[model samples]
Each structure stands twice: as structure tokens, then as C-alpha cells.
Target: MGHPTPAAVWIWMFPLLLLESRAGHLGAQETEMLEGQECRPHEQPWPTALFQGVQLVCGDVLIDDNGVPTAVHCKKLKYTVRLGDHSLQNKDGSEQETAVAQSLPHPCYNSSNKDHNRDLMLIPRDRASLGPQVKPIHLADHCPQVGQKGTISSWSCVTSPQENFPDTLNCTEVKIIPQKQSEDAYPGQVTDSMVCANESSGADPCQGDSRGSLVCGGVLQGITSWESDLYGRPERSGIYINICHYLDWTKKTMGSKG
Candidate 1:
């Protein structure tokens, strides 16, 4: 469940809609994961929720004690991270909030209106203490293969796209699609820095799914990259930045930071 359709976005979470209007760096339709199922109370804990003041901004994954990656467009937000958070409406007492120490978006990130090349950013774990409910995932050493199955986790508003957002974590299974196929969907915008995925059953969103992370075979494989609104369309595909492609930069950034 991801990527907000403009026609359907107004009916989703209010805070997300407001955030998109301001930056829209991930694109207008790239906000919320669509048609996702809620996780059990505190079932999965690696995903983190980012916020600007009180507004929900983006969903991120903790890759290490000192690194959590998200979209570069989210840079302007008053950065704060919520760990061990499963519910958005109700506090389950597992939630722990911490201010981000700093962020380093890719220096080569292209900010063109139509192209979102290298749209990844790294934020340190900061002062948040780690525990059972709060842990980091390992980064992918090898690139994800085509047709590989992966799970995407995000703070989605698909089920209750209205005044109230769902109170649990949302995630869905997606398969990595061929680069050529994704190329056809995105045209010249598809680059080596990016990868594509699709929810085979056509159950959920096809693009960027709003900064959601693509985890394959138990490791962080890709980060969602925003794209056109392909919701309800016959061709189903989602764009993601291949995390393995930027392994060097990620390590350097994390190692050089606090």
C-alpha cells in the first residue's frame, strides 16, 4: 500500500496530504502505501516514522546503530524519529522518539521536476537507545536479482483513507521487476541507480510507495523512489533506489558521522 493518487489522496490521511503539498519532492502521488495489511501489535520494529513538528513525514528503516535512510526530499522537515511504533493513533508504550543528529542526502541527487535520480538520504540513529523492539537491519551486499520476492514496509493509510489513519504498521510483498520493463514504464528516467518492483497480484501501489523500503531475503535491498501515479492502471510497477548501488557512499557517510 503506497503512492497517493491525487484524486484519492484528498481522502487519505490529512497530515500526509499537507506534507506533500509543501515539498512534493517525492512527487504528488508518492505518499502513502496502498492496500496494505496491518502488522500485529509491535510485530515488526525495524521501520521508523519521521515527523516535522507534529506532522507525519516519511517511513524509514534502521540499517545500523548509526544509520537510517530516507528520501532526500524529506530534508527540510524538522527531523525526528519514532522507534518501536506500531500504532499511529494509539500509543502502545513501545514508542520512543528521538531528534535526528544530521542527514546526508546524496550529493549527486538530481532535483529535476520529472527525474528523481539518486533520491536517497542517510540519517544517523542519534540518541535513540536500541532494544528488542528497536533494532537495525543489515544492508544488502549483493544487488537484488530480478523476479526476487521482497517485502515492503511503510506507514500506509490504505484501509482507512479518511480522517483517521490506521493504528498499526503496514507492509506488503512485492517482486523485483526487470529493469527493461521498468524502463518502459519510466522511459528515460530509469537509471542504474534505480530498481523497479511490482505487487504481482496487483493488490497495491506500483510506484515509490512513499519512501518505503524494499527488503529482500532479510536484508535492506532498496529504497522507494517516487514516480508517476500508476494506481489502478494496468501496468503495475514501482521505482526504488538500489541500495547496493550506493553501498560505498552509505558506509563512508555512516562511518564518518556520530
Candidate 2:
């Protein structure tokens, strides 16, 4: 569903939990749509697996004078992802839900390197409190092995004018392009810490899907960031911030006190 107007985040996906509409009608619709759907969680291919919903950003998140993304910066990690059930108010008789992310951003991130690409961060939450429908995914250290396949998942709003909530969650498959990790290349210098993926041809990610996850091996590996715009044409390439390099940083940042 669309986020309330004026708060449009070019790449942000609205969690079903925060929809403006009531619970019963939307919940029923979601259930019916998901019925018999072939898509399963974390089963998608690489590169695409790196797409994840970026959450809980702070005011310090900057944009350049030209409107290009300057960084994936945030002042805190109060942002969260909801799984299994989509209500801010925990339901009665509902299974105990868990908030698995217990981490934060790397302290050394500079907000000027368009290529640093080190913006979003995550942490493993306590799984012992997890509900039946909620669980964590795996993270990969590099781009998928040669010819690896991945998928990009999002609760993309398909409805028009984006009233409080969109009608459904949308998913599509994309392939991970094979590239080398290097220190002097465009995405190379950060390749060790980030990964990239795309559809072979014709297919591409869209607006309102930014910060969505690109998952692989059941773990979160990358974050959807910027994409190439050929001026008036659809986006050609999508960028993501690699998570592996900052895994340690996440732990350290969240562990610090102000």
C-alpha cells in the first residue's frame, strides 16, 4: 500500500502493519491472495535476495542538491520489520511475535560517497520469542556464485493514488549478474561489503520498493538503494549497500551509548 502522501519515500516499502485502513478487510484480502501462491520465503535466487525493506531512518538521512542519494545514513535503528502478523497492536490469542534485529549502523560511514553504499544495517534478534510465522533469513558474504539466481521481494503498493494501504504485496524474480569484487571498481571497492543483482532483460525494480530486501541463503545480504535512470526511461540498474562488511559495525554501534 502507499504511504500517506507527502511522505513518499522513493524506495521505501510500507509494512502491512502500518496500513491506514482497518484490519479485518485488508487481512482477509491478503490471505485470499496469498492462497495457492507458489512463492515461498527466502527461496528466491541471489542478488535479488539482497533486496530488503529499509526501515526506521532518522532526520539526518541526507539527499544531495541534485536529489541523488548521498548515502544510506540514519541516526538510529528504531525502524523495524514486522513478520507473521501485521498489526502494531499485538492481537489477543495471536502467537508471540519477535523483533529479531538487535543491531545498528557502522559509525565510520561518510554521507558523501555515492559509492560507499554503506547505508542500512541489521542485527539478529532473539529467536526464542519468535512466532510461528516470523523468522530470520540468512546473509551472504559475496555476490552469488556464478549463474546463481535470486529474487527481489517487496510489499509493493499496486493501488493507485496510494491511499493509506495498497491492496497487496507484490513479488518478482530477477537474476544476479556475475561481477568481481575489487577495490578500484564502481561497485567493486565496496563489493566485499555489498552485492548487486538484476533481471536478465526487460524486467526492473520500481519506485516504492526501495530499501526492500535482496535475500539469499535465507539471510539478508544487501539493501536496495539507487538505480540508474537513463533520463525519462525506466530504471536500468539497481544499487544496494552490502551488509557483510558492516555486520561487525552494526554490533558495535548498537552496543554503544549516547
Candidate 3:
């Protein structure tokens, strides 16, 4: 799952949010992530049934008083993403539905600002364990070369310009904009764990795209960080976690087989 878009007005659009909990604060707020009232652009539609088998869930997590991961909280909301098989959602030739079980944002991610650093997170469904149909997305250890093209997929609103919220999984290709490495952040606010892509202003992430995948060379690179401007602007910015630099950290944290 993704962090809450901090813009303010974006939160007001999602009125159905299950409020009453601490995480419910965002139910009445609106940010750049939710701008379009209705009518999305044609180019920004959800992917075909080719990815129909996979189920997408949206969840949120909270830190405990001791700063330890207390429990995995689940959400009633679910994104319409298909992986490889439609059977998961098929009920006697009909459709089945699933929701989010638990979502854990990176420990270093500061949702209060969401400028940069540790923008990626993990989402797992309690009812549907990581199985063949629903497998963990492969993490890459390298970044895409300059000018290289890649695909990003997610069930966020950015995918569909027509709808104010996500109705299905959307995927699109973007180029890796060449960026100069510097000890100092280039964008003035970017962090060491973040990288830039797609210099073209209109080719960036937009509203309803938080926590979606920034894929390149078959690698899940970044997540929808923030929009450069609100009100459904075309140009946007994303905050991606430096996956290659954090391989060791992930293995240790997730107990990978190596």
C-alpha cells in the first residue's frame, strides 16, 4: 500500500473511507492523489485481463508506543488488479472479491511530508497467502539506464484519468530520465534513497497514484511520491526507494532464502 497523499482536498473525495480509527484521519482530506471528479483520459486505463489473476489490496500500518511493528492491520478496500489467473476472482464463472490484509510502509518513510526516501512498502493479504496466483513482485538490484524504457502498474487513481479513484489495475511505460548523481539532493528535496526519471514534465505520476509500482527493466523501481501540482496536473514527481542499495536490508528484514 501507499502513504496518504498530504495535499488536504484530495482526502475529501474519498468519503466512503472507514473512519473512526487513527488511520481514518485521511478519510476527509484530499491531496494531489485525488483530483479528477469524473472522466479519465483514454491513454490512462487499467491493464487488460492479462494480469487479471493477481489480487490487489490497499492497507495501512501504525507504529506502536515502543516503536515496534505492533500488528498488521487490514482494510476493507481492494484494488482491481489481475495477475495471471482469473479463477481467484471467479466464483462459478462469476467474480470474487478480496481486500487488504496488512500493509507496511518502509520504516524510514515519513508520511507527514512524503518528499522522498523510503517510498516503497510491502502489502500482503491475510486470507490469500502469497501463492502462485498472488506472488511477491520481484525486486531488482539495479536501476534502469538513462533513456531506458520501463512499465509501471498500479491500482491507483493516476492510472485512470477519468475516475476520481481507482477502479482497476493500470500499467504504462515511462523512460528513465538521466540524472546527475550528487552528494546534495538534485531536486532540492529528494533524498539518497530516491532517484529521478522522465524529465518530460507531463510524463510523471499524478493523482490517485500513490504506492503504485515504478517499473523498469522488469524491476519494480519506485512508488507514486507526490504530484508537482494539484488539480489533476499532468507533470508529477515520484519518490522511489533505492532498491539496489537496500538488498541486504530487505533480505535481513524478510528472511529471504538468498
Instruction: Please name the candidate that would achieve the greatest lDDT relative to the true structure.
Output: 1
Cα displacement (angstroms), candidate 1, residue 111, comes to 2.8
Candidate 3 per-residue lDDT, tens place, 83-175, comes to 222222433322213333444556766667735555555433232233333334455677656677765554445422343334544445566
List model 2 lDDT by residue over 162-257, tens digit each: 212222233546555544422223334334455656553323334323524555555555566544432222224345566565555543543442
Instruction: Estimate every model's Cα lDDT from 0 to 1.
Output: 0.74, 0.39, 0.41
> How does candidate 2 score on lDDT?
0.39
Model 2 lDDT, residue 153, Cα:
53
Worst 10 residues of 3 by lDDT: 62-71
The candidate scoring highest on TM-score is 1
Question: How well does candidate 3 score on lDDT at residue 221?
Answer: 54
After superposition, candidate 2 runs with Cα above 4 Å error: 1-81, 85-103, 112-116, 123-128, 141-143, 157-167, 180-192, 207-209, 230-235, 250-258
TM-score of each: 0.79, 0.50, 0.50
In model 1, residue pairs whose N, Cα or C atoms come closer than 3 Å (at least 3 residues apart or on different chains), thus clashing, are: 1-33, 1-34, 2-32, 2-33, 2-34, 206-237, 206-238
